[model samples]
Target: MILPFFVYGTLRPGERNHDLFLRGRTLGEEPGRLRGVTLYEGPGYPYAVEEPDGAVSGELVTALPEAYPGLLTALDRLEEYVPGDPRNLYERVVKEVVRDADRAVVRAWVYVAAPAVAARLRARGTPVGGGEWRERR
Candidate 1:
């Protein structure tokens, strides 16, 4: 399914990967929130791990129609996601995110921590408070 992407880490605007990957490819970027996910700090980025009672702040990014294919491939690579790969650090999943503007819930692609990673994080990972990567101390 073709849907907007919910980004919470380096891919968000003003972050390191934004200019390199999404600068000219997105049609729109707006504040959004993904429920039932906890944000955790990675080495230099962040990870969203599924949780029963949590919410993550991010941006819902809509790619330009012509850039969809390439953008999707690039994002997967950036997130180190490989379908069914046990070694993958992240997995691309479809989730509902609420737009900050109008509180409209929309389906979007979300790169979340892979099973093993999520398990590890759940055991000992440091979560970003308030579920906001950018504001993490």
Candidate 2:
């Protein structure tokens, strides 16, 4: 079955990792956003953390049924997420994404940093006020 995913950083279209991980594997893509989160720039990519009223802009993509299995594996590796791992680089979670085109909301999987990691990134990494990785890059 097809699976929906919310990608905010390198996994987004045109980013370095997109072709390697998503490209032909996706059935559809739409501009989307997640509220209550702030985006911060890392060395060559960006990551998001929850915030009081912050909003992060990203893309909502549907994985093709045929590619779903491999896609999920690759994405989990890319995000450095191991099931039940407390020290994961990012936690994969289901969240509501607001489509930018019509303000429609859809449930999708998103990777979010832990609060401590967020705090560290906020203090050390550059804050992307617009909450968009593509725009900042």
Candidate 3:
């Protein structure tokens, strides 16, 4: 089955990790936006946290059915998301993402900062205004 991902950080197309993990594994990609989330600068990457009136910019990637298992595995490792792990750095969840081209909303998997981590980060993290990770410092 084909799976869709909403990627805002390194896994977005043209980003370093995208070339390494998603370039040939994806069936297609397009700009997407997730509402009620904000982007924050992490040590070397970025993280998304919930916010009342925010919209995070990203890419919606359709995983190739044959390559999806491996691709998803690699992504989980990269994001430090272990299924059922309470200490996971990120948690993969289904969220509604709006396609940039047609503004169509679709459910997609997205890695988001865990609740406690998000609260701490929100307390002091550098917010990327407009929720575009690539455009921030």
Candidate 4:
């Protein structure tokens, strides 16, 4: 079975790296929100925080199984999503993201960052929102 992942960070569509990752191969993307997580931005990509009362809002992007491996490597090269090291920010893993307005669930891939890294990024005081990634007219 395909695993569920939440793409609250840069992996969401229309971001800086969207064309490199999810442009042609993307199955679909839908507006999704997950509670207990918030956005944290750094000099580059955004991070996700698992706060008790926080929530993360982004898209649910489904990709083909064959394309996922390459996508992972690309993300790793971009955001440096690593396997080990607790302090390492942006760990790519399967996460449950809401589909169809919380009524249905689907398998997706998400990159979650460590809280410490997120905290540091927050301290830097950068704007946090998916809109910032978009090109303004």
Using TM-score as the measure, the top candidate is 1
Q: By TM-score, is 2 or 3 better?
A: 3
Displacement of the residue 63 alpha carbon in candidate 2, Å = 0.4
- Residue pairs in candidate 2 whose N, alpha carbon or C atoms collide under 3 angstroms: none
lDDT of 2 by residue, 105-126 (tens): 8888889986567878867877
For candidate 1, write residues 59-89 as lDDT tens digits. Answer: 9999999999999999999998889999999
Per-residue lDDT for 35 in model 3?
96
lDDT of 2 at 121: 84
Residue 59, candidate 4: how far off, in angstroms?
1.2
What is the model-wide C-alpha lDDT for candidate 3? 0.89
Q: Rank all candidate structures by their TM-score, best first, as comma-separated numbers.
A: 1, 3, 2, 4
* TM, every model: 0.98, 0.91, 0.95, 0.73
Counting clashing residue pairs in each candidate, in order, gives: 0, 0, 0, 7
The reply for model 1, stretches above 4 Å from the true place, is none
Better of 1 and 2 by TM-score: 1
Q: Please provide, for model 3 over 14-41, each residue's C-alpha lDDT reduced to its tens digit, 9 standing for 90 to 100.
A: 7889899887888899999999888998
Cα-lDDT of candidate 1 = 0.95
At residue 77, candidate 1 shows an lDDT of: 90
- Between prediction 2 and prediction 4, which has the larger lDDT? 2
Whichever of 1 and 4 has more TM-score, that candidate is: 1
* Every candidate's lDDT: 0.95, 0.85, 0.89, 0.63
